[model samples]
Target chain A: MAPKLGIVAGSGGLPAKLAEKCRETGRPYFVLAIEGEADPATVAGAPHAWVRLGAAGTGIKLLKEQGVVELIMAGALKRPSLASLRPDWRAAKLYAKVGLRALGDDGLLSAVIKELESEGFTLVGVDSVLTDAVATEGCYGRHRPDAQAEVDIAHGFRVVDALGVLDIGQSAVVQQGVVLGVEAIEGTDALMRRCGTLRREGPGGVLVKAKKPQQERRADLPTIGPQTVDLAHQAGLRGIAIEAGGSLVIDRDEVAARADRLGLFVIGCRKPS
Target chain B: MAPKLGIVAGSGGLPAKLAEKCRETGRPYFVLAIEGEADPATVAGAPHAWVRLGAAGTGIKLLKEQGVVELIMAGALKRPSLASLRPDWRAAKLYAKVGLRALGDDGLLSAVIKELESEGFTLVGVDSVLTDAVATEGCYGRHRPDAQAEVDIAHGFRVVDALGVLDIGQSAVVQQGVVLGVEAIEGTDALMRRCGTLRREGPGGVLVKAKKPQQERRADLPTIGPQTVDLAHQAGLRGIAIEAGGSLVIDRDEVAARADRLGLFVIGCRKPS
Candidate 1:
């Protein structure tokens, strides 16, 4: 029997791609796709079932039924509206055990992993299989940062990197040498829109996105794509600096094409010492 | 000779009031006020000379000229547009040694204090003189928190406190348990306004302001007053939660009056565990 794996699919095509890669490697895998978030096309390409994000126990039971002993998480259930769906007994018990720290995505996922592991499923990192797709250092789009924006980028990168190291946030909206906004749970797109209304002047804005030092790299990896570039353009943000190798650039070719057309500077920055 | 204290005045009446209190105690003092930010009333009330916020060398020289010995920071400063401020030789040199971290208010002030102490002048905290004025726990305005808002406030308080603990920021904008913004150098008003747009579709937001656990109490106590409440109302925020006795409620009566009229929740939270 080929080695079996399970994929916890969130939003986007990444999970579908991962499944295809698994097929190429001749590994039989099962996918637990999040309802309303996972792409239908992606689900159709793999052996999968639709489930609510909060119903972790059901997901694990299905995986167990399929003889899956290992799991990989891909994408994210975008701004998961957790207001409606009720958790099952396994999820409720897991919630009671995890308490306050379990409020955020990181905590919620870690708790789910622990529960699955206790049930004899060994969770594998998505990166262990998708290493080649991770981002790389240097200019990624047609536009290179001008000297002034480069200086702002360097300064902004340092500030956002420190913010990330503290695990307070991942992205900061900076113009010139001053920070206008730090992305908390609201995320980057919301931050850019905030900037558009704040300072009517200044040379648009520079956005810095970096990975936290303590962040789990495989799950919830910081990502950028054409949508991000488009959002930045709409919100008047001129540039973005993302950590190389530690961040994911979804649809690299399309994202670069969009960045190029928009004349936006999208550079992959290495972590500063 | 009467005991002399130093006042590092920023942008309001608090510095002058603190100076008057010093005089009442028969303590002679020197006031180093920020030129563009300090109220003219503050300048008139204290024995002072004004200098730009970033002009560290000039500020140090003036304080020394006034025979200043101990320092206490009071009031607030208009956060300088760092992109425009031309740092003098002294400030630039300090930046070379300290880098971007030195740009934050606490970092810069601490650096200044270190330099002053090296020259034999001691630094005193504002709390040493204004302890009686610190706001204690409980309600201040017409609105008491609904159970849901209280839950959100508790969640907001924890997140804001964590932000402070990391020295990432001292204020956060929250709504329904989601953090909408975290303060960087942008300050509270900017953070509130940013959140207003982000949460426009939902209920209004909450502003949680607190001092960092490691922050110097005397030099930079968090403050809120009528204008702060007014700004929150203007930005569509529903409530304000500040740490009790860790902050100052400037013009307390006026703040209460405004909060009452606006139907806003303004309360000092019990010092967090």
Candidate 2:
């Protein structure tokens, strides 16, 4: 009997990609799609069940019934307001244990992961199932960062890294040595849009993305895709830099081709440990 | 002979207010306004001359001819783009001495101050002229910060203090220990507007303003006015906290009245040394 894999899917195409990879590799898998977050079309014609964000107990029950032992969490779960959630018995118990300390996304996710592990489920990282989605180090487009852009990239990485340490954000726009913008609750796209407004008639800035130092890699890894390239270009940025092996580059070939077409460089940077 | 006061006026009513105070006190003063920056209406019918931003030598020459030895720099001077500035010999010399280190506004101002002092001008702080404008400690409205608002105020101060250490900006919006936004190149009003957009339906955030740790107090001091109270109300904020004796409260009575009317608190806090 094949070992069953269970995907606790959220929003975006990563969930579908993971499911497809499992099918192609002849692995039996089921998706527990989060309602209002995961697209139903992504898991169409597959063994899946829909559950609300706070229905951890029900999801575990369904997975156990399917004899699933391995679990993978993929895609984004937009932070919902506390008023909006109706947590089931398991989620309620979990929240009671974590208490107010679980206010941050990382804290809540960590608590959930601990509970799942205690329940005997082995969690796997999405990158392990979709290796090609992980960004490789170095430039991937026809246009590479010029000397000035290189300086901006380095500065942007420092700013983003500092921001990550504070757990405030993971992206920043930097030109020369001045930080033009920093992301907070507004998210990356909004930050890029702001950089667009602040752009002057000169060498543009660089958008740097990196994972938080204490981030749970298996649950949520920083990701970029074709839309990111477009947004960066629209923001008049020279390039994009992501932490190598720590960020997901969705539709890599398309992202590279778009970067080439837009004359923007996409590089993977490795911050020194 | 009484040494004449030189007013290096920038935009905003602060310059006008300072000039008026000097006039009322029977102190001789001359205003050297920056072209393309200061409002002509602010210095209307006053002893004033306009010099382009980069023509620092010409400005000093005018002040010397007026026998202005004591200089006061006031008002908001939006950092102009590099290409827009047309530096004269003196300005060029100052920039060469400062080199690329003058990228931030504080850096450029510091360099300018050094040059002025070297040339025998005694720079004075605006607070020396407008003593009543300085904010005093304690709450100044019908309402005071509740326990949660006090916590948010403390958190806001810490965030702004950290940002100041980085010399980024001097304003931050905080709610329940979470920083909603921090001002960068976007300025405080924009940060407030962003907080307005990010505000949740609850006991809103607090706007904290403070002087940078290394800030040259004689040149730039954080300021809040009646408009700030209106904006805070519009943003659904519970209160505004400013460093006591380190910030200017323009239209103080009106600001307090407005805050009281809007059920918001205007507090002057003293961050311990």
Q: Judged by TM-score, which candidate is best?
A: 2
Lowest lDDT block of 10, candidate 1 chain B? B100-109
The interface RMSD value for candidate 2 stands at: 3.0
Where is model 1 more than 4 Å wrong at Cα?
Answer: A1-5, A16-31, A39-48, A65-70, A78-85, A101-103, A141-167, A199-205, B1-102, B105-133, B137-168, B173-180, B185-207, B212-221, B226-240, B250-273
* B117-227: candidate 2 lDDT, tens digit per residue: 999999988998899999999988778999878887887777677667666678888765556777777878888898898865457889999998888998878988898
Predicted complex 1: CAPRI docking category: incorrect
lDDT of 1 by residue, B1-273 (tens): 645787888765678768878878888888887877678887685678878867888988887888888788787654454444578888787767766532455665566667667777777767677666687798886788776567667777777666665455678776655566788756777777666665633456688888877776756677887888988888778889898978888767788888999999898998656
Calculate the i-RMS of every candidate, to one decimal place: 5.2, 3.0
Q: Tell me how candidate 2 scores on lDDT.
A: 0.83
How many Å off is the CA of A94 in candidate 1? 0.8
Count residue pairs with overlapping backbones in model 1: 3
TM-score for candidate 1, residues paired by index: 0.66
Give model 1's DockQ, 2 decimals.
0.19
